[model samples]
Target: MLFSTIVATSRAVGTTRSRRTKVEELRSLLAVLEPVEVEPAVSWLAGEPRQGRIGVGWRTLAGARVDPADAPSLTVSDVDRAFTELAGLAGTGSTGRRRELLATLLGAATTAEQEFLVRLLTGDLRQGALEGVMTDAVAATAGLPAETVRRAFMLSGQLSVTAAAALTGGADALTAFRLEVGRPIRPMLASPAPSLADAYSRFGGDVSVEYKLDGARIQVHRHDETVRVFTRTLREITGSVPELVDLVAALPCTSVVLDGETLALDPAGRPRPFQETMSRFGAESAHDLLLHPYFFDCLHLDGVDLLDAPLAERLDALQRVAPEHRIPGVLQPDDAAAKAQFEAALAAGHEGVVVKDLTAPYAAGRRGRAWQKVKPEHTLDLVVLGAEWGYGRRTGYLSNLHLGARDPDGGEPIMVGKTFKGLTDALLQWQTEEFPRHERSRDAHAVYLRPELVVEIELDGVQVSPRYPGGVALRFARVVRYRPDKTAAEADTIDAVRALLPATDSG
Candidate 1:
């Protein structure tokens, strides 16, 4: 198929807000792809290339500009082959080699196709072609149910693979996806609850309240002597976390899949700051900052699959296999008892608690209310220093806010962090209209303001960050509301922001 066909569909999907229209556009595109083109086309439309990060950055793309070809002749296979070659480049002269390849690729693409290729390479192809929408489109094209497609994706942990299966072999191929022992599956997700009372009220007494650890999520898969650990995003980090690999390999069973959290601990046994735990994940070697695994659910044991089993049965399997590593929790607790567990989790320097429905099966890759997380939310009034140009659905609006904390001595608002979350349509429109009035400077990416607008920001907490002048940054920060009643000088100070960090992390 022509690459222009995919670009046109991507544009159509992005311009429309209607989910049905987006799905239809994607479905039409998917239906026409040849067998060899299925994976790359589906992946590109989903805003990810099957080759996965070809090391091309905006700078490289910017420097290697070629005039567009007058006609559209590039095929889907042509682009895929170029990306595959790019992904294989390494070591000396790879940069020059990549530039030459990009130049050749762009030289053959028309203007629209060139734009699409640049966005695809830079990881900015945010059309409404999300995984869910594409999953529906794949199912529609293949005459299969959406649930079947979703299940296949969740089990395989790769939409490209799932799309290929559905296109070639139809329903039978999709249902064949199972919890393979060595392959990583998407971990189940939890929804946020306002409070423990709300979570307990929703699930009644048949729930397990477990500590929501302030650590990195890990899914460990072991088959005999080989153990592989994957992050929440399914990135394999087996070499980075040898300790976890060894621990999962030592489980009594020959093959098992465990879902859990891992964090560094202080000498006194309290959980270390979350950043400390995440730092080890990026390192090639295990550091002095060792991570201890805390198993929360068992997805597979020996030859049996517990993915279809209820939480009770999964917990039973977890208890039998890795009782020593299971996360601290109480099963079937009442409202008051669940509240106590929440308090205990907080007291242990962990994130609050996850109240899980004991009867629900593991809804992998889905963030449903079957598991509700209740955490103490903190809010701060901060100054909006600038705003960035939005893309996709947020096009033409000033979306991401550059937030700053007040300097008590009145020097300047110190830069803290940026957050684009929690902004509604009304807020987006209001900011687009109001922010320019306070604009001090402009750039290609952002409009810098006078730091005169105070906005209320809700956050999970704060962590030490050398990235900011205050040496701390807000964690999971989102817009609450614009504080029209407050001024920038009256916004939360740098000292106040630093105080929000945990005592262990504040230093």
Candidate 2:
């Protein structure tokens, strides 16, 4: 099938917020596509040349040059080959050439198709139907149930693999599948709850609540002495975390798969500031820094897969095989108890705790009610320095706002961060109208506002950074509300800001 056909269906899918419409459009497109065309179509959608896990990609020039009469039968292997060639080209050539190549391939598509193709390629497809929706699509197209496709995905760790399996082997193939090592399965994620009470009411009294440390989520797979560590996204980083390898290799079990968080800890045993941990993780220095691996869940022990096991069972296995120091458990069931634990955690310089359900299995890649996290809100009084134009639904509004913090010695406020979050339509309109009144200068895209307005900004935590003028950046920062009563001069100072830094162990 022509790229244009795929593009058109993708565009139709992108234009609507409805999952049913998107699935229908994708199915219609899939009907006309030869199995061979699936790779290019998906490649064009995902934006990357197919990589190791996904099918292979082909050179656009070579692929487009193929005569329609001689076009080979499209198979999963062909897709894999194409992606391998694309990956090689991407590694050696200029970024512009790669982008140009991608654009040329996409240009072979229709305008509507081009829109969806671009959205997919750029990872900006916001239809709210991600993997789950894709699973539904695969199931619908293959005459299988969504659960069959989901199970296949859980085992194989690749959507396209599951899709192909369902299309070729049917539902029975999926149900009988088993997991293999060296292949990464998707990590499970937790959904949010409004409050602790709501979470408790759902799970009842027997649910487990574990301390949710602020750290990077990791999955460690060990077979005898060999160990591999992967991030939540399944990207391997075994070499970067040598200490973790030592710790995992030392575990009692001969073969195991464990889920946990890796945190940099100070001498006091408190978690280091997130910025410090990130910097340490990114450092090129061979010198080792102290890291704590807090094992919370076990998926595989010995040669047995525990993915189907209950959380309580997994916890028991985790305790049995993993080291005592690595296991993380602190029970807090009630609001008062949870709040007290939260305070103690903060006082001890640790991030808040994660409350989990003891009965839920590891729902790989699915963000369900299995786990819930609670962290103390970090709010700051910051001055608005400038505003930038918004896009799409937010077009014509002052959406991006530059924020700054007061200098300790009292001079110009240092630029700390920028945020487009927490704005209502009314607030946007007010800012658009009122900001120009305080305009100091103008660029082609943005208006520089006077550092006069002080707004209360909330964030997850502060990270030290070389990019910001303040030498720090806020993580997950958003607006709480405007602080109309506080002037910019009355904003918090650098010294006051430094005090909020996590305590560092000199040892």
Candidate 3:
């Protein structure tokens, strides 16, 4: 198919507010794409290049001044091949070569196609739809179940390949995308619990209350002698952490996949600060920071796949394989015991507790009520949209913050609230020095940002509001910390914020 067909469909999809319309348009586009063209087409539509990043940044794109071609004739393969070369460029003089190629590619595109290229390259498609919606579209087009496609995606860890598989071979093809011994699947997620008591009441009989550790999530997969560790986003960091490889490879089982957290403890046996643990990434640490793995669930063990097994069964397998590394937990049925465990987790210098439904199978990528996490206080990761200037002792520094929540529909973050509290003098100094680097626009009072920085904001609660676009304002929001490890895409969503609303009489 011609590249213009995809571009026009994308424009049509972005112009509408109805999700049904978006899915219909995307499905029609997917229906026409050749089997080989499917991956690139879907990847572009989802605001990412199939080649990933492609060595181009906002600076390089902004510096290029290529004119548009009069007509549209570039094929999808043409763009994908160009990106393959662009992404392969490295070394000192790579910038000139990449820019030359990028300009030549952009010079061949019409105005609309050029706009699409810019959006795709800059990670700002603003199409109001993303991989999640496109997954639905692909499923609708293939006449397959949505869950089938989602399951395939979660296991395969590649939506582009999964979509193509469903399109070319239908639901039967998805069955092949199962838990492999070495491949990392998307980790199972949990929903936020209002409180420990509420979560205990929800699943009283079949629940395991476990310590919610303040550490990095690691999915260790082993096959024969090979062991690979993947982050939450499935990026492999095997070469970066030598100690982890040794620790995971020493497990008793031949083929296993364990989901767990890795952290370093201080001298007093308390969990070290998150940054200190993160500092172990490349540095030879002080006092030889040992990464302790705390296994909570096992997806695959020995020769059996436990992804479909209940949590109780999974935990049993985890205990058998890595009994020494099993996370601290207790199978509790009474509210009093669960509450006591929650308090114990906090007292141990952990985050809080995760109360999991013991009978629920491992629901990868689903943050349903099967697993609920409760912290000591309410904290949310929100995007910083802008910052207002300070006065008096904080003069000339950016003090007040404008915060936003990720939209449920994968659109831009919605403005929910703002705050200047909880920032130390050092934070204020850092903001003054760093805020200008991310400035998108500026006024006398505040400087608007690109919504790229995610800040952990602790708030009392939320209230009904007429001002914010989300129809709710965060009450007493304050910055707890800056999450450099996370991106704006991972920020807590507006739907999550709305769930904090004060209860009604009907409930």
Candidate 4:
């Protein structure tokens, strides 16, 4: 397939408000791709590169200047090979070589293809129709059930590969995907609950109220003597924390997959600051920080796949394998009991409590309402669109920030508000120096970035807005911290912002 085909399809996908139109746009492209080219094409159209981060940075991309070809002639394989060569360069003189490679690739591409290449290489493909929408497209093109496609996606954690299997091998091939002992499946996620009383009222009876730990989520996989640990996004970090490896290997069961949290603790066992935990969690080598694991749900136990089982059965399995490590929780309690549990979690220095339906099966890769988490304050993981230069005492630094919420339909972020609050001298200095590296285009007041960085922002509430693209604006927004572990793809959506709007309006 020609690379221009992808660029045109992506434009169509991003411009529409209707989801059916987006799926059909993607489906048309998927139907034409050969099996060998399926993965790269799907990955690129989903606003990601199959090569991941290939050492290309803003400085590298900014330096490349090439006159694009008038005609579209670059094949999908041709572009993939060019990226392969770019990714293979390293060490001395590698920078210049990468630049040469990028220039050559761009020179061969048409104007539209060049723009697409820049966006894909910079890791800021702003087009909507991410993994979720593309999954439906795959199902549409392959003539398979959407549920089967989604289930395969959750189990494999790679939409590219799932799409390939479905297109070539069909439903039976997708059914072959299961919770393997070594491969990490996508973790189930929770929606926010307004309050404990609300959660109790919603679930009525037989809810598992558990403490919500303020730590990095970890998924541990053990097979015989070997153990592997993965983050929520399914990136392996087994080598960084040998202690966690040993701990999971000691579980009573021979083969198991445990979903849990890991964090550095203070002397008294209270959770450390999120930054401190991320420092250790994101490390390449072990430091003084030692991480401890807390098991919450077991997906696989002794060759039995518990992902289809109810939460109650899964919790029972978790208790049997690692009784002491099970997260503190109360099952099937009254509203008062659940409220007390929530209080206990808060008093014990935890984030909050999660109320879950015991009978609900684990919905991997789906943020369903079966589980809900209650917190003390409203926090949104928003993308940093850009930042402005500082003034007066804060001179020579990037102070005010332009923030945006993710467009749930998979379009570019919708700018909601701006903030200059919640910065220390350290952060101000860091942003002033580093923000430029992400700059897509700049102006006098602000340097607009490609929207790759995710920051946790605390806000008072949201209000109607005519200026912002989301039709709402944040109230009293301030940065809590930068989330280095998260991606822009994972940021909270514009729908989440509008959700905070008042129930009734006279307008």
Candidate 5:
């Protein structure tokens, strides 16, 4: 099959919000894709390219090389060779070479193929269809049930592995499989629930709620005395957190697979700023940075596989094998008690809580009602500093808005973040018209607005950053609504910002 055909199908899949439509499009494309072309198609749709910067003042860059003549000769083996070569270049050489290589490869493709390739390389293919959608597509193409494909993916971390299984062994083979160690499985995630009460109602009874810390998710695999840790994206970081490896090595079990969040905490036992924890992992002397791992689930224990086990059983095994300091108990209770516990967790400075059904098995890579996160409604007061032109559906509107907090001692506002989230089409139109009235200047793609609008913003949490002028940036920040009642001078200040900062070890 031609690359353009795959690109066309991907475009059709992305444009339609309906899962059925996506599945159908993928199935039609898969039917014509020769086995020899499958790997290349997958690589072009999922691979990440090398990136970096030349100097402090230079913009970060991506690498790709495309020769039009090479497009006809492209094969699955060639794609595999390119990805292997690109991965090898990730940590070496000037950033320019990598960017050039990537540009060359992508430039070789036709326009539609280039669009698909760009989205895949940038990791921002907002089609709401990733591995899950692919699973459905594979199942539809192979004449198997979606559940069968899902199970195969759960056991084998690779989508290609699942595809091969569906194409050869058929659906029955998927159901008979078990997961192996040393090989990673996609991590299960919580689905959004309407409300805490609603989540509790759905679970009926016998559920566990755990504090959802504002930290990075990790999977720790231990064999005898050796342990390895990986992030949600499956990047190895065992060397970055040597202390965590030591902690896992000390577990009583001979071999175990544990899942949890790793957060940096203060001597007072409160969670430290998220930036501190993230910085700890990337620091030159990671050991110098105090970090802690809180184990919450056990997927393997003492030569036995626990992936097929229920959550309650896994939690029990996790507590038995892991040390007390490292294993925090899940919050299990009745409806009223769970809500009270959630409120208590929030009051104690936790992000929120994740409620899990006791009997549900780990649904790797799947977001389902088996687990749900309950975070408090987010809101903040921010001053608008600028606006950027919108794209796609947001075209002709001031979609991206720059936000800042007041400077201490009354100086220029310090820009902390920018966001395009939480804007209705009507709101976008209003901002596009009103922002120019306060415009300080206009650029090719953005309008610099005067410090005039004060809006109520909301976010998950504040993270430490070197990028923002305030030395801090908001995580998942979005506009709650326009706070027209407040003037720019009345917007929140740096001292107020400092007050909102989570208590840290430095204090």
Candidate 6:
């Protein structure tokens, strides 16, 4: 298929706010794609390339200027092949080689195609066509149930792969997707609760209150001698975390998939700062700060898949496979007992507790109310829209951060408020060095970003405001930390921010 078709469809999807219209447009596009072009086209529409990051950035793209072709002649395969070559470039002259290759690819495209390719390469493509919408489109085109496509995607952890299967082989191919012991599936997510009382009221006594640890999320898959560890985003990190691999390898079960948290612990067995734990994730080896794994949920054990099993049964399997490493929690606890567990988790240097419904099956990659996380203080993972230059001793650094909440309706992030509090000198320096890479536009007071970075912000509450488009502003907002594990799409939504409004002033 021609690349221009994709550019036109993306533009059509972006210009409309109706999700049904977006899905219909994507369905029309998917229904006509050639079999060989399915995966790459789907990946591009999802804002991720099939080749992953090709070492291209905004600076490199800016320098690769070339005259555009008058007509659309480039095929989807053409861009894929060029990106493959670019991703393989290395050594001293690789930078120049990448620029040359990108220029060659862009020079053969028209203006519209050039815009799409640049956005795709630089990770700045923010149209309404998200993975969920594309999944719905795929299901619609294939004449299969939406849940089937979603299940396959959750198990495969790649929408591109699942979409290809659905488009090519229909229902039978999607059914072929299963909980493979070696392949890492998407991790289940939890929604935030107002308080412990609210969680108890929702689930009654049929809930398991588990400690919500302050650490990086890890998913370990062990099949016999081989053990692979993946981060929450399903990126493999087996080599960086040997301790995690070895720990899972020693489990009595021959094959298992464990979902849990891993963090560095001080001498007193208390969890270290989140940054210290995350720093080890990018290292070649488990540096001096060795991470310890704590297993909480079991997705697979032996030969049986527990993904469809209730939390009660999954916990039983987790106990059977790695009882010693299970997280601290109480099953079916009374209100007083659940409260005590929540306090105990906080006292033990953990974040808080997640109250999970005992009867609900594991909903991978879906953040639902079946599991609700309760913390003592209100915290939100918000997008960094822009940052202002610092003053006083912090001069020359990006200080005040303009925060935004993710739009649930697939639009631009909604601006909530700004803050300069809780930023240490080290954080300020890091912001100055890092924020420019995501720059969209700039002015004398601030450098606006592409709404890509997710930062955890703590706020007392929110109040009605006309200063921002969201009609709400964060109260006493301050930076808790930058959540490298999360994507901008996974940040707390505008509805969540509005849910924090004062009771009498909810208007």
Off by over 4 Å in 1: 91-93, 126-129, 378-507
In model 6, pairs of residues that clash are none
Cα lDDT for residue 177, candidate 3: 83
CA RMSD of each candidate after superposition: 12.0, 13.7, 2.5, 2.1, 12.9, 1.9
lDDT of 5 by residue, 1-507 (tens): 555666676666655545577667767777777775664554344332222111211122232434445344344455445555655564557466557656655666665555555555443332222455677778888889888788887777667667766765687767666766556677887754546887787888678888878777788888877788887656678888889888888878788888888888888888887667777656555766678888778999989998888999998887788757443334568777888878877877777888889999998876567987777864556888888999998888888989988653233577888999989888898998898767667889999876668787877767677898778887788887775434554566554445445668115
The residue ranges of model 2 lying beyond 4 angstroms of the native Cα positions read: 52-83, 90-129, 280-287, 331-340, 378-443, 446-507
Global fold similarity of model 6 (TM-score): 0.95
**Which candidate has the top score in lDDT?**
6
- lDDT preference between candidates 2 and 4, better one: 4
Per-residue accuracy of model 3 over 1-507 as CA lDDT, tens digit each: 878888998888766656788788989999989999999888888678878877787789877758899998899889888999999999998999988888888988999999888777876663322566788899999999898998999898878899999999998899988788778887787777789888878876689999999888889988988988888768777776678788888888799999989889888889998877767654543336777789899998888998888999999898888888889999955777887888889999999999899989987865678999999888888989999999999898999999999865556678999999999999999998998877777999999886678899989999899899888999999888887766676678888898888787113
TM-score of each: 0.78, 0.67, 0.93, 0.95, 0.68, 0.95
| Residue pair clashes in candidate 1 | none
Question: What's the candidate order when arranged by decreasing TM-score?
Answer: 6, 4, 3, 1, 5, 2
Candidate number that wins on TM-score, 3 or 6? 6
> For each candidate, how many residue pairs have backbone atoms clashing (under 3 Å)?
0, 13, 0, 2, 18, 0
lDDT of 1 by residue, 1-507 (tens): 999999998888777656688889888888888999999998888676898888988789988889999999999999999999999999999999999999999999999999999877765563221676788888999998899999999999889999999999998898899989878887787766656887888977899999999788899999889999988768888999988988887889998999999999999999987668878888888887889999999999989999889999999999999999999999998777888999999999987899999999999987678998877876677889899999999999999999998755333578999999999999999999998867767999999886668887989888988999788888999997785534564576677678667768866
Q: lDDT per residue, candidate 6, 1-507, as tens digits?
A: 898998899888777767799899999999999987899988888786888888988889989979999999999889888988998999999999998998999999999999888888888885322777888899999999999999999998888899999999999999999899878888788888989999988987899999999999999999889999999988889989988888888889899999999999999999999999999888877687899888889988988999899999999999998999999999999989999999999999999999999999989887789999999999999999999998889889999999999876566788999999999989999999999989988999999998789999998999999999899999999889999988887888888899888788796
Compared with the true structure, what per-residue lDDT tens digits does model 2 show for residues 5-69? Answer: 55456556545656687677666665555665554555444334345322222333323321132
The per-model lDDT (C-alpha) reads 0.86, 0.66, 0.84, 0.86, 0.69, 0.90
Q: Is candidate 1 or candidate 2 better by TM-score?
A: 1
Give the poorly placed runs of model 5, Cα more than 4 Å off: 47-128, 172-177, 326-332, 378-507
Report the lDDT tens digits of candidate 4 across residue range 1-507: 888888899889988877789899999999898888899898888777788768986678778868999999998999888877887889999998998988888889888888888888777684432777888889999998899999999899888899999999999999999888999888888876656787778877779999998888899999999999999878899988899998888778899999999888899989888888778766788888888888899999998999989999999999899998888999999877888898999988998988999999988877688998887877888999998888898987888999999876677788999999999899998898889878888878888998788898988888898988778888999889998877777788887777777777313
